[model samples]
Target: MTALDPFTDALDCPLYVVTATAAGERAGCLVGFASQCSIRPARFIVWLSKANRTYRVAARADRLAVHLLGHDQDHLARLFGGATGDMTDKFTRTAWHPGPGGVPVLDEAPVWVVGRVQSRFDGGDHCGFLLAPEAAQHPGGDGVRLMFLKDGPDISPGHPAD
Candidate 1:
């Protein structure tokens, strides 16, 4: 393996539950590839796997909701990461409410942001959606430790990567 491969594999990054809505359909999935990409305009980039239902919905969605899952909320992570929406109604099983632009917001997420899609980029098997913040919610409480990718090693992706 290359030198970068091991380094990347050892990194522990926060996981997210990204949700989007379009054409009256809503979808969400677990995400490990996302970050604040810009500060001048305040942009966040969320990379969604092309093979996932959330990616399809996001393509036509005007906005998206990025949620921070607590370290103890692995069950929430499993719900979004372990099951495919193609055959399952994931939202119905979880607690969420419609946010800006009809995006589904996870009620349990301690911290969350609703952003309008500013642009999209082609990134091999995954696509990046640049978001401009529209709203943010931070429930004052203990700082919930973020769930990391390493924390969900057993979580089979809801959609297999191409």
Candidate 2:
């Protein structure tokens, strides 16, 4: 029981699927730590766990695609969040196309953005990737809600803590 655990445990925000490709290697993972970080310059930050395969590919990738999963897309969220790239080829199992800078864009996401990696920061076990959006697709919302952490209670993380 520490000061940070309370804050971290209480957060139940929207989930995102972050995809990236580098040197012909493709990777993606479910992300809970992503948000709009800037206003004037228009920047977003996505934090990837260092122990995940997506982070390894993202290290050499110049761009990434961030997707907002609808509440109904629980299976998609579980696939990305509960499966590890080291053992599962998530891209092949899902529908996607090569986006800007070879980043894979999930077709199921209601809203998505392709952005260039402008900067990176070491944030303990995870690293923050700052993105400058280059392109986006916002499908007309049909009252569909974004998926939240609490929605995926059955999902067991593919990459467990060390």
Candidate 3:
């Protein structure tokens, strides 16, 4: 693999905690690989690392909820990013409500969207989950400044090896 400095090249976009539930199991993780892919159909895509517990749950899920964190929501990021779901119940520690498709939605999030998985594409170590927006809600106004890399250091990867 080509060695590159992600710290220097990384763009600070809004961080999101994506959650998915399927077969009585639920998983959520902090995601950095996400973007709006299409305009006409308004499709969005979020990529999850193959090694992430969330990805395994997502594979069987019909829908996923993407929640945008505010500048002060670092705890949410840590819960989903720093710790592995295989060892702990992330949802039990956080305040959440049932979202579309019965997915867990973090109550502290400023904005969130529930989308149906339309397609999936494998990209090396991550799998791109293409979503079609089914419902969305933004509790905060448009003036809210989302958490980004410029706010602090790039910390989404959560692991030193990554």
Task: Name the top lDDT candidate.
Answer: 2
lDDT of 3 at 59: 95
* TM-score of structure candidate 2: 0.94
> Could you tell me how far off, in angstroms, the CA of residue 32 lies in candidate 3 after the best superposition?
0.7
TM-score each candidate.
Answer: 0.94, 0.94, 0.89
**Could you tell which candidate, 1 or 3, scores higher by TM-score?**
1
Arranged by TM-score, best first? 2, 1, 3
lDDT tens string, model 3, 6-64?
65376767778999999999899888779899998999999988888899999999999
Tell me the whole-model lDDT of each prediction, alpha carbons only. 0.91, 0.91, 0.85
Deviating ranges (above 4 Å) for candidate 1: 1-3, 140-142
Runs off by more than 4 Å, candidate 3: 1-10, 152-161
lDDT of 3 at 131: 96
For candidate 1, lDDT tens digit of each residue in 1-162? 677888888888898999999999999999989999989989999999999999999999999999999888988898999999898899989889999878999999989999999999999899999999999998777766777888764787777755
Name the lDDT of candidate 1. 0.91
lDDT of 2 by residue, 93-145 (tens): 88999888778999888899999999999998999999999999886757768
Give the higher-TM-score candidate: 2 or 3: 2
Residue 17 in candidate 3, Cα distance off native in Å = 0.5
Q: Clashes per prediction?
A: 0, 0, 0
